[model samples]
Target: MSSTALRRSLLAASAVLVTAGVWLAAGTASAGTLTGTLYRDTDTPVARWLAANPGDSRAAQISSRIASQPATRWLSNFNVGTIESEVAGYVGAATRAGQVPALTVYGIPNRDCGGASAGGAPDLATYQTWVNGIARGLAGRTTLIMLEPDSIALQTCLSAGEITARDQALATATRTLKAAGAKVYLDGGHSAWNAAAEQARRLANAGVADGDGFYTNASNFQSTANESAFGRSVLSALSGRGINGKRQVIDTSRNGGAAGDWCGDDNTDRRIGRYPTLDTGDANIDAYLWIKPPGEADGCAYPAGSFQPSLAASLATGAANPPTTTPPATPPTTPPTTPPTTPPTTPPTNPPTGACGATYATSSSWQGGFQGQITVKAGTGAVNGWAVSWTLASGQSINQVWGGVLSVSGSTVTVRNAAWNGSLQPGATAEFGFIANGPAGTSSLSCSA
Candidate 1:
């Protein structure tokens, strides 16, 4: 899609992008990192929902599925009891492991620009009440709070008159949280999604003056180079607005590399970072964080609410293990096995434009094997293996494979264990092919091929 069309779609998604949160540290350290999701100690509707269901399911699933989007990352459905317990678990783990955990709080209202990730405290009054409870849970703990992800920037969807009231509430929340002693990093969305000036203006207007600064690259990838560029611009704007005194953080969670898509579509599986460590490359940038748990859905990319285990494994600490090797073959001259392939078919189509209603679409495609092509350009940087995964609508099989190994499970296809074209640079393109055979009229395209 044209950049203009992409921006329009992003602005529309700005409403939903407002829906999440993240965490980081006060000082820099070596690369290994600690990260965790915030869960309430109370066993409210959300806890009840997770308990009753199994395997990556949660109570928010009902509303989220019905809305055809992700459930707001922050919701009050978690009771105080759950909050306390969860916080204790986080604190305890951090304390014991000697690692700080990155956490996000999303219970704020109108998250994600009213995208599928909407919902929050009923109003400012109620949100403050919830904040009080959250503060109590966070008391004496050293944790970074990604305060109200999309609340500030995405508020344009609100009626003009209501904007002041919204800002007022945000100011109040910022003060209250800061007073409670929590280190708060207000989300600045990603580098590509919001203009620096506009982001700074909204943040300043929303009272970021009282904040620790802003966060960028949260759950989106525009590249660290781009993010740093974008962040400095936004910070410059914020400075102009008199809110530049604070530092900023970026969600380095899944952005080991960059692609245009949101989900794991590029599936580059760059093992540049694990938990707590950040390579953000900016001193004022504070820290790079894995705020978004590796492998968690940006929302169902392949199957509704299903977690991509391979993708998850690739992201998790498991990637550190040594690879297994086979013993020498009986026939010393035997040729090695050829990688998987399918009969030739249609070449890849260009990537589609606009943010589709489908959850986690960006991160879930092969990204036209662009990720593999990244290093080809530089020809000098270290190159690692690659993996790409996607879930077909069902009844689909590998029509062809080029440079990578292909594995199938039910409706999902994972590309691993094959030769990638060349070293992948920050933003490269790659493509794979597939053909679906289902009942007549059942095999319609779910999105751009």
Candidate 2:
């Protein structure tokens, strides 16, 4: 190949690698490569949803899509008496599985600015005592601790004195967790909410110098690319302040789709993001973790942290866009806001070959779910009706299907043409999209009428 062709090919390959989290610059060592498998909690919210709603339309989708992925286990309440044992049991399970447990320590006093996720320890002293129990449970094994979700970032309600007190408490909590052999990531707000410089300074106040690093997008829905880039900027800022070598993680729990309201059930555009893993190609990014379990309310729709299967199903529709890193060229601004119930007006680029033909593609991918579209085309002859079938992977299921009728019997899923779409001229095509539960599955499609 010519040198130019080689360079272009190399660049294309590089872009693909970068999107999978292998973003490279100069001498930055990737964070997740050295770690063990990130832990998967058996009792995650989606797990419970599967148990209770097996007969529900979205149960299978939620089971294979969201519930199968590992999410951070947040210790939000301050029941000191059981905190240690509770943590110990979780850690033990992770140890048995030989996976690295990811824990979120959220009992900070006045968490969430007293908003939907309000309530923490009564005071800093109680918070410390509570953290100590969490530490004891760790017992010197390696774990990832997201010290607090918004303890520093969402501090508008606090006075200067109050912010200072919270800062000190976080510093103490970091030390306690680290001493117990945990890799503690102090909160670094998120890219959308705080400027890199400001959050770096805030993290400094919260003792980023002593922690493993800082984490971003915990319970917030910012794209992983945006959050990971923000983390690099924060690290650079931290280095300027004489604190260096800090790695970061992003909560890719529910940031799929567009950047809109980060709370409640009203937003249909929200989707789950990348699954948890430390293998981010970017050395500065430790992992893209699902810190906030999908389907749980952010205080707007249901009580804070209430898991809803229907909500999970909606978010899972991004194929539950599997929280991939780089999104394809900018998504059309208006497309996500509108439901995809209407078939696309455009014709298929692929001409019809047989009486029926079908194709599937992932429209956009994010943490928990992905959006997929299937195009049905008439081959050499006009077709009055058609059906397409494929076997879903173990965890693959459908949430909302449009432009077609959907049914699942065991792993095999079949979609038949909708009323308007069933009638197609030869070589004409009709398309449909749906929110799927898991990653885009193998495309061994069979079409018939």
Candidate 1 weakest ten by summed lDDT: 1-10
Report residue 415 deviation for candidate 1 (angstroms): 37
Query: 1-449, model 1: which lDDT tens digit per residue?
Result: 00000000011311211111223323323222222222212212222333434365322332121111111123223232345445555544543433333346665545454343333443556556666766666554545566766666566678886778777877776777667555566768777777889888887877778867777765565566777788788888887866656666766545554456655633655332322233334456655654553444443233212233444444433233212221111221322122101111112233223211011211112211100110011122333444445565544344433234457788766654233332343233333222223311112222111
- Whose lDDT is greatest here? 2
TM-score of each: 0.52, 0.65
lDDT of 2: 0.68
lDDT of all the models against the reference? Answer: 0.44, 0.68
TM-score of 2: 0.65
lDDT of 1 at 115: 43
